[model samples]
Target: MRECIRCGEQMKEGCAIRVEGSATGIIMSTKENAMFSGRIGYPKVAICPKCGEVSIYVENVEKLK
Candidate 1:
């Protein structure tokens, strides 16, 4: 569970962040040349309904390392 930084409330997790007008979501990569090489990951989101705060994180952190 995630906690809202602003309100100190429990945040709703397991949400996904997507690009506008695109099916693909946000990506995180460890390599400088991410398009061709290195580890990649899709970020997940946690939102606070009380204060409208949003937090992003990578689920597959091991993959990026």
Candidate 2:
């Protein structure tokens, strides 16, 4: 059961949120920069309907390594 950190209310599983590298689509670094390379994450989300708070859950953090 996910709980809203901000409002302390029960949260309901909502959707999958896509997370990407911070430099995505930004041509500020060298072509070889790993920061600009594509890295993605799909984390399940939970939301508190009453307070409109959101939470993200990543099943495997090693995938980001």
Candidate 3:
């Protein structure tokens, strides 16, 4: 359980949200050049139902590399 930073209320652990890197325009959309381009990151999130606040953090930053 996590605490809401704004409302000081106990927050509930939500689902794992998938996060991916993005680029603007037509830079690159194919997976072939993804290695030299964007990166992948997965962050665990917690939500406060009382205040509707959200908090996101990466449990293992090393995994992003």
Per-residue alpha-carbon lDDT of candidate 2 for residues 1-65, written as tens digits (9 for 90 to 100): 77789988988885655438664432222234563453343456888989988877764556456
For residues 1-59, could you state the per-residue lDDT of candidate 1 as single tens digits?
A: 77899999999999987689988756677876774466566778999999989999877
How much lDDT does candidate 3 score?
A: 0.63
lDDT of 3 at 49: 85
How many clashing residue pairs are found in candidate 3?
A: 0
Best model number under lDDT: 1
- The whole-model lDDT of each prediction reads 0.80, 0.62, 0.63
Residue 16, model 1: Cα distance from true site in angstroms? 1.3
> Tens digit of lDDT per residue, candidate 3, span 9-54?
9987854554357542222222456734453344577888899888
Q: For each candidate, C-alpha RMSD in Å?
A: 2.0, 7.1, 7.7
